[model samples]
Target: MTKADLVENVYFRTGFSKKESAEIVETVFELIKQTLEAGDKIKIAGFGNFIVKQKATRRGRNPQTGEEIEISSRKILTFKPSQVLKNAINEGAN
Candidate 1:
């Protein structure tokens, strides 16, 4: 769901005011963003882990021009779902 949807969900679930729900969602998102920016990982039980990984510079070819270029190093965010989450998703499919 989108951020607005999240806020709405929170509002309905918690009986919080719409403005308060929005703030809660925004605060949670801001906290997550700040943690990622600090190169730290976030792990939630029965959910998933948010990890930041570093990728070194590499050579890559331009798809259209066929020109080789250097791809700069960067920090990437990745998520690994917990086993519980995986099982829940699989069960839903069945």
Candidate 2:
């Protein structure tokens, strides 16, 4: 579901105003982004973990020109799902 869908569900469950729920969802997303930008890992039990990984500089070839270029190092965000979540998905296939 999208953020808006989440906000609507939360508002209905908590008896919160639509605006308040929207703000809460926005705040949570902002914090998640800020934490990731800071190179920290976030883990939620039964959900998944978000990690920032560093990639070393490497040489890459340009597809069009076939010219070799040095690719700069960068940080990439990755998610690893929890075992519980993985199992749940797998179980549904049976």
Candidate 3:
């Protein structure tokens, strides 16, 4: 779902005003972004871990032109879900 949906869900579950819920969600997102930008990991129990990984430069091809290119190194974000989250998803399928 989108951020608006998340804010609405938070408002309903926490009995908070829509504005407050939005602020809370925005703040959480900002914090996560800042943490990752600072090269740190964030682990939320029962959810997952957010990690930043550095990738080295690699050779790549331009699909359209069939030309070879060098892909620059970059930092990427990754998520590893907790077992609890995996179990919940599996349970819903049954």
| Best-to-worst TM-score order | 1, 3, 2
True-structure lDDT of candidate 3: 0.98
Candidate 3 error regions (>4 Å) = none
Candidate models: Cα lDDT each: 0.98, 0.97, 0.98
TM-score of each: 0.95, 0.91, 0.92
Better of 2 and 3 by TM-score: 3
The better candidate by TM-score, 1 or 2, is 1
lDDT of 3 by residue, 1-94 (tens): 9999999999999999999999999999999999999999999999999999999999999999999999999999999999999999999999
* lDDT per residue as tens, model 1, 15-67: 99999999999999999999999999999999999999999999999999999
- Judged by whole-model lDDT over C-alpha atoms, candidate 2 comes out at 0.97
Model 3: lowest-lDDT 10 consecutive positions: 28-37
Per-residue lDDT for 74 in model 2? 93
Candidate whose TM-score is highest: 1
Off by over 4 Å in 2: none
Candidate rank order under lDDT? 3, 1, 2
